[model samples]
Target: MLDADLKEQLKAYLERVTRPIEITASVDDSAASNELRGLLADLTALSDKITVTERRDDDQRKPSFALTTPGQDISLRFAGIPLGHEFTSLVLALLQVGGHPSKLAADVIEQIRNLDGDFKFETYFSLSCHNCPDVVQALNLMAVLNPRIQHVAIDGALFQSEVDERQVGSVPMIFLNGQMFGAGRMSAEEILAKVDTGASAREAEKLKAKAAFDVLIVGGGPAGAAAAIYAARKGIRTGIAAERFGGQVLDTMGIENFISVKETEGPKMAAALEQHVRQYDVDLMNLQRAEKLVAAGDDGLVEVQLAGGASLKSKTVILSTGARWRQMGVPGENEYRNKGVAYCPHCDGPLFKGKRVAVIGGGNSGVEAAIDLAGIVTHVTLIEFDSKLRADAVLQRKLYSLPNVRVILSALSTEVTGDGQKVNGLTYKDRGTDEQHHVELEGIFVQIGLLPNTEWLKDSGVALSPRGEIIVDDRGQTSLPGVFAAGDVTTVPYKQIVIAMGEGSKAALSAFDHLIRHSAPAESAKAA
Candidate 1:
């Protein structure tokens, strides 16, 4: 199943194995089972430390395989062809099961090992979902670390009956101990915080004891990483507190316009950004959400209160908290979220395979989503509020050429109609005829662009545009002195990644200049 170059790469990665590992597959006589068997044979051929076996006695999911050491109690399984976005998860499972050490922090490993109760985690994922691997890999690592923890990464496409029974209309839907746990992208730290309960309190205590920073950034997207690197390069006490590092960039699928670099995936770019920032002395804080930004106090330090009940003080603050996918406020949209309404077509499109769906918008993202969904879904209805699509000429051409797609312009999405458990259709109003219509579909992908993440700063004296974006000067300075903003959260014209990085660097420099002017001696300033 693997190509020549892929085989060479797998061989090189498998050479790190120091222990014998066995792959036990419980597969039926189906085409998917044959594919899985072929993949296993290819893996076995790549390394001497790996071996494959068949098992029919175990009451496990068919077309699935388990990775375990000879005498270890590890229980990690993949209930589908772990290719595409999940190929990394498969490789990591192989390596880690063969005695390759994990890169997780010492404390996190200990926390996983010390968990008292049993955790049977089943994660439903799609091959196209860029966010599913993180959750799968995390749970696999937990399973490898603790015998009490077991994880099975199931491909929702392959297990249609189970997905329908569970009402899973979204990718990366997770169930724990036979109950719905959560959904969407989740990191190891976030998962730990949810299960460990006391982890947040401990983290809050640690953050409270931290000293005031010279330059503190409040996001971890392109802008925040650039600001952190620039500030740390100045030999200042730099720190970054982000709700989740990578911001909206993590949700992006493809980036062909990042200059110099031809193309890259979102997760790959986010990892590179984080790695670049870590090369500096900047203190990186992930999963730290900022709740409020306090103006300069008597101590000449600005404070940012976190949702975790801890507050951080800084000499200068940079707000780069980026943006999130704008939601359609129509009725039933919220109620049907993940049930039939999804924001990312790449992640959730496979879940609606052979089913009718609608793409709500006529912009670049919306058109692209419709074009992509045309291949996988039975029919795609593209609804636009404007008279014409706002996408580029080439994209619009490609979208119109799709046989399975239909376009409706000057149509406003009125309401999302769904059964209590899943979506059945969508309601829309035709502006030209002043008439309403409904389209039967299994899913709705909303691509109405982004909303700035500045709602938390609304009452903090920070000036915001009518659209809620942070208003900044040419130097990236917000209305609040000693405070700055950058990226999509600011009034910047373009929300591109490169522009955000430049704005972040400029904001850092402006913060540094402000410090120099304010901290200088008054006598020297008067003489000058």
Candidate 2:
């Protein structure tokens, strides 16, 4: 099923296998099963250590296969053809099961091995989803590391009955032991923290014991990564505490405007940013959300209080907390989230294939989402609050060209109507006529805009604009002394990745200049 070039690459990757591996598949007379057989045949032809066997009477899902080492009790299964974004997941599973060393940190590997009890994880994913691979690869690695853990990555598109029965309207929807675990992109560390209840407390204690940093960045998006690298290059203690590295960038699908790079996806760019930051002597902490920022007191240090009662002290702080998707904030929106309401068209569009959906916005994101969905869904209704489309003229032309798309101008989304279990329609009102209307649909994609992640800074004595963005001078200096801000969270205009990175570098340099000119009494005495 793989092309010639892909086969050559697969062969090169399989050369890393140090042990024998077996593939046991359960198939029926179906097109997907035949395709799975072809894939397995190609895989077996690549490496001498690989073999495949088929058993029709197995109790597992049809068109599924299990990869296992001969002498090991570990096994990772795929209940559907794992192509598209999941192709990397398939390669990683093959090499990992065949004794290839994993790249996870030693501590994280040990933690995975130490987890108690059996974990049966099943993740539903669509092939087009950019965020599904992370979740699939993480769980697959965990299953490979721990013998008690078993994971099955299921293709939601291929298994319509299972998707309908579980009411899975979004990609990367995970379930552990038959109960819903979570939805969306999740890292291995996040998964471990959830299953292991004491993991958070242990992590908090570790954070509390860390020494004060010279420059500490709050956020791990493009801006935070740039700040950490710049500070570390100056031979100072630099650290980054992020809720989730990559921030809103992780949710993005296509990025073509990032100068130099012709085209790339959000997850790939995020990985590159993280990899570049790791080359420096920066303390990288993930999944840590800053709850409060305390201004400098008697010790000339700023304190950042974490959500789990852990506080980090730093001489200078750069806030690049970034932004998140703006919610519609209408009735039933929250109650039906993931059930039928979604913000990411790239991630959740495939789940609503052949169904009717609504795009709530008229800007570039919304217009683009409508254009993309028109090809997959039966029909798309584009709702906009403005009288005219805010997208580029080219995009508007393309959107208008689609026969399956209908645009509604000067309309306001009032409420998201659902059938208690899932969304069935949407309610809106025409602005000019003040006439209420309801459109029957299966899903709603919200692409309004972004809101700065500065709610925590509201009572923290930091000067903020009316829109809740942190107010900063040209030097990236915030109203609070020794504290600065950057990226989408700051007052800087044009929230682009390149701009954020530049702003982050400027903020780091500004912080360093402050340190050199206004050295603390102890440091000045030491220099003497």
Candidate 3:
């Protein structure tokens, strides 16, 4: 908490040192509108502050104003709550009003600028999503580049009533021109394509698309978000498909070892990344789902059919559609996942230091957890259904070296014996002999493999590996020229957030290459 004298001194110092900035704030009539009014009043009091702009339409409805600033542009929403990383989003809006260039690469800027159309985007997000910040940045850039394009970002927490009113059930939902575009993380290019083509189709009464993007990425996971940012920065108009925005990262309890940023939760990190990528405006679609993806033209144009009877056309597509952790099918599993039964050891291991725990599954994940837990917990009992351990030689040696770790081969978890509140123990059975055993513990770690959320892409023409992963080259390119893949759902071995993000970046860069080459002919023809 800042003292009154300190706050006053800080405000005065800011006022004296900063030059005047042009920005505006608006207020609406509602119970939650006080926040907007207060923010405006505070800014108005400060030098180089946000100005108050109020206007009413003929119907006497208050308008949400777009205020211009030296470094960026801001959209004022009274009675709107910006929660989670949304506070950062608000700051980004101010930055946009201040005219700050986005953190995206130069190439993405060129690609998005070349596309033609008017787009109105509204992205609804919660503070929980790890990738929502990217979604906001993408939409904000669209709002910046084209005045015809309007973007609105709504916070889920502060506006629960409004969220319920809109029937938004999840984090990171985007609505393009009053249509549900899907949720989760989407690239700006994909979003713009949808908007441009949707409008064109509506006007012409047939499927009409003006331009084809080199690659379209779906899902803004570590893989998808990285793909969009890198692709856009490299000058590709990439599009994204998402159900809520952010992807599974948002649900992650905590994240550490993400490279540069050593320790940060999922939401904060996602927000920062999103802010960096929004500069390219790479056609992000939040809360939008693809119903069908069919090949369109010989030029590798793929027609993505959305759920709302709308269609988007793209030359190439990157399938960064990621995977979800397989839930423990036991009755108490859902009730105590984050509470006790954790899937990610890196994220939640520290929380159980010196505690007794058991690791489930027979594969490498389970063995790895047993080894990791041996150091953190008092006793680590590894339960596996297969008769033999599945870990590599080195990992097996490591697990054997740990005295606290014990392996139970041919064992399967029959029930997650818990205290009915949090996880406390587990009951397992031998697969071959039907022998049952019980272990006392404080936590349970489910180390089973994750399930890829690619059921919807069964016929999307993107090739999947035997392990149900989208097969991709080093650059995240799939067997198809236009389609790329990334993340855990892809063939990338490392399932860490950082690895997925890196793959996403690679995919985006590859997409940009495709676009630049495709547009070269058009650019040369125009030059001629």
Candidate 4:
């Protein structure tokens, strides 16, 4: 069942319906049926305009939901419970069926509108997988927009038999017309590109740079998108370069604490973010990661070296290359990633709920993860490398406040032990006594630290923190003038979406201010 706050939020979002959306669920003997029934019932109760008609299908191995208008059949279906991270898809599906269009770029809409042939897209996802929702939303919205396209998002866990038949080994494994389309997360542009059967996957025209620009943003995460949007409002030549736009957000699950939006999955929000960025005049360079940055001297253009061997230039720059989760580098750590070892508790924690789990950190994040996992999982073993917990006193109190959590201080994670299919447990060492010990847990949430993605600027002379985060001042200015930085890659402390977005806006404004103060002379020199 949805929580009171989340339920209220969903109700509010669903209030936009001018007509009822019919949901007919075929419940079978699957293990997820009761929970799925409760979830659907709760959703139906939220709005008078939403209704659920349940039928017991003896042959049905899994539950199915087909949302339609009155007396109209929509082939769009969900093959299992849409709880956990998939909750976003369910909500988005309802909205789509109820006539609330999820925004996409005008150009993208036009392309989908012109699509020919009957298309079938099946995207396999886990409810706890954060990256699944975006692809689901994209495919679902495509189906909603184009009647010729039928999208079915099947929960990979519930339908293991079908999953095995399809060889779906990962989350967001998509099949276009029953052919293995893509695995993991995807962007709207990429999804649309794939949907265009007439075009090759590489047929998406490469985004080229303008001769020059006033501001160029590197990295298309939340920060880069925000910066691009803000910079474009100034009517300046603004461009953004990113190998992949969503960054960490693509892998994230459900985001509940994103300020106003009570509940949103990573992929859906990332698509919306990209869509909003596309609304502006910002030049977008997709699939282009910045390989290096060349700082411009006074009145010179700063250059951004991309991974694809292309370089772009601008008068002012905003570095928003985001950070990645710090790895422990133990044996099987990489091997068992997504198999049982996960970096994001928010994204993958629910999958391990009611199972035993371990949190590997003594810091605020680690302690927070321990507390959170303790509530979800049956037992939580908190491991720390220090003699004492390094988290703040308040967080330590909250962590200690939990009864299901046990603390092991001065411990170093040794190896992630697994059965080859999934994580079964891990080994740890007593840092003080050097005694090796093994613990049994189904999941491991790594919360050690975040390593900033500023390595590309290493030779560019951007002053970085000892840990490699870009150092920026209050105004979001980097060590070099005409260059600014924001988001997790910067030394701005907290690494939240709202914080990154706000920092990006600040960086863009500061870049504009810097241009106003420094541009006249550069223009005059060009004239002379």
Q: State each model's CA lDDT, in order.
A: 0.94, 0.94, 0.65, 0.82
Off by over 4 Å in 1: 522-528
Model 3 is weakest, by summed lDDT over 10 consecutive residues, at 56-65
Give one digit per residue, the lDDT tens place, for model 4 in 117-161: 888889887776777787898888888777888889887667766
TM-score against truth, every candidate: 0.98, 0.98, 0.51, 0.76
Better of 3 and 4 by lDDT: 4
lDDT of 1 by residue, 1-528 (tens): 999999999999999999999999999888999999999999989998889999877788988999999889999999989999999999999999999999999999999999889999999999999999999999999999999999999999999888888989898999999999989899988899889989999999999999999999999999999999999999999999999998888888999999999999998999999999999999998999999999998899999999999999999999999999999899999999999899999999999999999999899999999999999999999999999999999999999888899999999899999879999999999999989999999999999999999889989999999999999999999998899988999999989999999999999999999888887886587889
Task: Tell me the lDDT of candidate 1.
Answer: 0.94
State the TM-score for model 3. 0.51
- lDDT (Cα, tens digit) per residue for candidate 3, span 300-365: 577777664666778777776678878668867776654567666543454466778888876777
Candidate 2 per-residue lDDT over residues 1-528, each given as its tens digit: 899999999999999999998999999999999999999999999999999999998799999999999779886899999989989999999999999999988998999999999999999998899999999999999998999999999998888778878999898999999999999999999999899988999999999999999999999999999999999999999999999999888988899999999999999999999999999999999999999999999998999999978999999999999999999999999999999999888888888989999999999999999999999999999999999999999999999999999999999999999888999999999999999999999999999988999999988899999999999999999999999999999889998999999999999999999888788766879999
Q: Which stretches of candidate 2 lie over 4 Å from their true place?
A: 520-528
How displaced is residue 240 in candidate 4, in Å? 2.9
